[model samples]
Target: MRRIATAVAAALALGLLLPWAMPATAASAPPAAAAFRQEVPRTILALVDLREEDTIRLSRIHTMVELPLNHLGLSVVYWNVADGLPDLSRYPGLRGVVTWFAGEPFADAAAYIDWVGRAMDRGVRFAVLGQPGVRLERGGRPVPLALANRFFARFGLRDDDGFSDLTYRSKPALADGTIGFERTLSGVLPGYPLFRKTDARVSSHLVMRRADDPASDSHLVVTGPAGGLAAEGYDRYFDAEYNRRQWIVDPFAFFRNAFATDDLPKPDVTTLSGRRIYFSHIDGDGWRNVTEVTPHAAKRVLSADMVRIAAIEPFPDLPVTVAPIVGDLDPTWNGTPQSVEAAKTLFALPQVEPASHTWTHPFQWIFFKDYSRQKEAPFLDRDGTYRPTKSDDHAAETAGEVSDIGRYAVPRAYLQQPFDLDQEIGGALDYFTRLAPAGKRAVLVQWSGDTSPFEDALAAVRKTGGVNMNGGDARFDADFPSITGLPPVGLPVGTERQIYAAGSNENTYTDLWTNRFYGYRNLVNTMRHAGAPIRLKPFNVYYHMYSGQKAASLNALVSVLTAARATELAPVAASIYARIAEGFYTARFEPLEGGRRWRVRDRGALNTLRFDRASATAVDFTRSTGVLGQRHSQGSLYVALDPAVAEPVVALAEIDRADRDPPAPVPYLVEGRWAFSALAGEGTGEGAGFRVAATGYGEGAMVWRVPRPGPWTITAERDGAVLWTGSATADDDGRLALTVPLSGIDPLILRLRPILRPSGGAAG
Candidate 1:
């Protein structure tokens, strides 16, 4: 045994080291061996329409195929086989056909049925698309009864007890022991392929029992109940797209049943190759136009298969031109009753900038063919007489028309012409120049198409002001080339042509990639042509709401708006304006500093000069007079004396201490420990009334003291001379206080002589 093992190891080493040295058969082993073995099935094909019906079916398929078990190693081929016959030859190893036959008008039922039958007989599995009860017919003829019965039996549907009940006659048996009448032959056939790995007995296929009847030999398949096709305990299929009006038997269960019965063998796994094929037929339409059924079916297909599905839409190649102002009325007037309400709705959208394309787009002369007869031409005189033909006369008339539209007719931020015709463009400019306010010139001009002359004309318009060229050259095939002979620096490149393509039939919403790419490209192109003076940005996007009524279009708009908001380039001022209009008050202004020189070190320091009606002098400060035994006014306490004064008295002004009352008075001493004095100048005699000047005084002044609160007299005297005297009291702080009268005292001079003081030493 050792010797034999040594020899085998030596042979293996030789084979690895020198493959060519091995026998000829061994040298070609890899390819020859693979060729002899079967390939595992890894992909399947699904054919659907490009309309809403396909969307519904695809949605349903997506749901089923999305399951982990089904998706593990499978792929799907989604094809819009609207042309009837698919190029099956392209898919060399195509295993089976999953088809929705309801929507198409079949030319010959017998021929098509025969073709399908032959395909099935040739070992190609047929997975009928859609749920049970979905009817289909060729040339308006129902599929043969025998063919239908055979298909039904494959799905475990058979009449028992020879009952003639029509309801049960052609019904498929369900897992819940109930039966439902058949609507189409495929209604009784499996809608999905069964893998070899999936159990045949315990699966839904065996669980659904068929009655013993003459029709038992028929071949049919039904999907499981929990599957999207059937609702709980209900034999009917559930239509996800509609308002649940349609129901049919489960197609998944039927397929599993057929596989288990051995009538349809499991696809040869060894022959399967994991290659996916995608087919789509996209045509421009709104969301509502596509039947709700299409998305439903799509969901199911996507769920059942692990494949990439693409839907291509044939969007219209709209010629680039300034978007026409659909309707316009006088500024003082409201919208016309006949105008679409959508215009108003559009206006309400974010940054829905309005522009005039004349009162009705086409030049007035062209629009009202009989402008001269109707006396509507600008050249017509007030009395309806035609003016003599003259160059300046024509200019004046054109100006009047422009004035009517600019001043009275349209309130839009900009104006547009119907076309870039020389007369129209040049006339619009002249008219606007005449009608525009002395300082305000028309800032923008609009025109249509991508003609070379149009590009040149744009340069001329820009030299005078700004111009917006409509997206006329926006063809899928047209490569947007750079424009030349304009300004030394050009406008943003992409802004040149604003491509307005119709939305996809399946998705009515915005196309993020298309819009972003196209919009950005135009802006970049414009910038490249015109340079920075021209503020280039994608200004508008237009779509028809009635196109397909697709919710996707609305959804796309929302998404685009959201994305625009996220973009830094989006106008910030507009957003702020919107917020302000919503009544969301917020102060973004910083306080203005008047350049005054004042160091406010403390809260009390601020009170000295910061005077308004709320100023309280007594509560803000303490006071001291020039001498003792003299009457002083409480108002004098806040007086700002010259710096020449002995102590340069600052008077507490009204001490504001937190522990005291809200406007607490500052303490002062008068009769006992502290004293205040008033002195008459040299000229003034002791016998006459004496006076001392004090500068600051106000209505809020009051002399306050601590201890016992009582009324007291304050005499203003100097050198035996008396100026004035007043009675006051010490309420909370211990000090004699007086209310100084401001009447007749422009520059008050008074003597403060405290006649009495509180018992607890003069308040300090």
Candidate 2:
């Protein structure tokens, strides 16, 4: 979704200082003298003008600026500047602040500039794109020039008393070719504020030149240790029509250079157990629709029932979280007795993680945040139909007055009663929990309609011991080419955060399910892009229950599952993914030194840490504690942390050293096809026996690198009863491979013991 806003330009040319330059390569950039020993360094504060920006979802900060930061494994906390500056001290993990403004500067310009100066004073970096808010007026007069110069001085630049409007004759040129990637700047550029470098340490990464003169060069993007500056039009390029936009700057390299993140440890939720995570989720839309798929069509079976039989029943190997709209299951609402039975049967499946999609689906959650009963009274009807009545009497009164009510003519999908946060969160989850089989509970609340719930709604879900997810709608493909289409882990709502689904649902793939019903099969393309080059997101098979309504849609849904079955993934429940996403915002990483080591704490349910551009590093098992295994992919090391251990220490050493002078025989996981966990080794040398647990469908396949090449026997038992006993010898690489037939969802305890042999080659 794209929104149009007024684009402001402040093309001032100030030559107040001497020009100097710094090296532009990351290799040449000097390291910070001291590490943030206690800081998390994951959250970036983004300032946007909500007046024109609407919400974070529609803001350029989230759609454009957040793309690179998210790819760099960082989350953004957006703040409306009109609300004044946020207290930076509260965010100890505050890595930096980025601004993208469209409207006039906030009322107080001195306060905004001083806030930036104060943030930089605390060792926090500052980056400004588009409007920097430096040029402002208070009570109809310009802010003091000294305050603006001080802001420019942070990036080692001085504002010159110059302005230019000859942008129609200017084009952007990269100062360094190595910094450019993918899209390049073309056509005439927009007018921009001009500055001269005051120090040699500041690097000019980009420049603008006049086509007519060919000699007038203005610094477009400059960066230093304190932060950087990306002039207007340099961050993103809008077409002449302003209909589409492409990144003119290599955001990955630019933000990396801007934030000095060459050695930062990124908390990665993209992978688990040394493999990319794969999960699936179903929204509760169209649950009552009847399936038209061949055999099911003649019987007039409910889409929910057909989905369970065709999708859930056949794929016991993959776990899918099924959230039913509470109103679709409760008989008092729009649900029938048959719908209730279908929901109960689906929740009983061991492969399904029961969840709730809210009591009555609120089309636009923000509409009810500050709901007014008197305002809604004229349009409301409580005839027990749970449907909105034709409000011809109040049509004119309600028309053009409602905001945040996306698409839907009414505020909610069902409107028999007034909106209630508790009912939508806790009440809905409680109803679903009762339908779930013994021991299993609703672990997550799937956001309905707009999916943008308020802070209280998220907090209510947390109160029910459940997590919340949806919203984000992350997708990256040919249509939505840039990583901008892929949102970060979640959005911060006051004290609570709303976790987003990893991938967009079928509704997006099928163009709102109106045409191209088979387009969902192309989801593999997004899965491919999100993994390669850099694994930015997990493999998520997200769709609506309505996908079962048509044969083409049903086939597309199965195609995605079949493709997932063929990939190397750690398949987990969607609730587990929500928890992992929650962990991304809460996990604290205390850097030990450089980026080689970190003391990770409070990483609840988050089980992995990734270090990019670390191909030469390997986990130093002897020096590290609470490590399960590590895998090197895309030139990055994915280290899986043991959840059983509290406050694990991850230490990285040279891979060459670990390979040459290998440590004593210790069984460590290499990779597995199933979800593996709770690995513990006992004894020493060849006598060591490792105990691990796993659960999955299909055939259970796994490999563990042992101390030496030799025969090993694996005894698998469930609930103290031996399920199977198998043995295989370690190969030249000391990799022990085992295969077991997994027929159910019960967790299996597997014990791997080295089969000792006599010196004569006989069994001992």
Which candidate wins on lDDT? 2
* Overall lDDT per candidate, in order of appearance: 0.27, 0.73
lDDT of 2 by residue, 510-543 (tens): 7676678898998898889989898888999988
**TM-score of each predicted structure versus truth:** 0.25, 0.87
| Residue ranges of candidate 1 with Cα displaced over 4 Å | 1-35, 49-72, 79-82, 103-105, 129-136, 147-764
Q: How far is candidate 1 from the true structure (C-alpha RMSD, Å)?
A: 36.1
Q: What is the alpha-carbon lDDT for the whole of candidate 1? A: 0.27
Q: Give, for candidate 1, the lowest lDDT window spanning 10 residues.
A: 270-279
Per-residue error (Å), model 2, residue 37: 4.3
**Alpha-carbon shift of residue 142 in model 2 (angstroms):** 4.9
User: What TM-score quantifies how close candidate 2 is to the native fold?
Assistant: 0.87
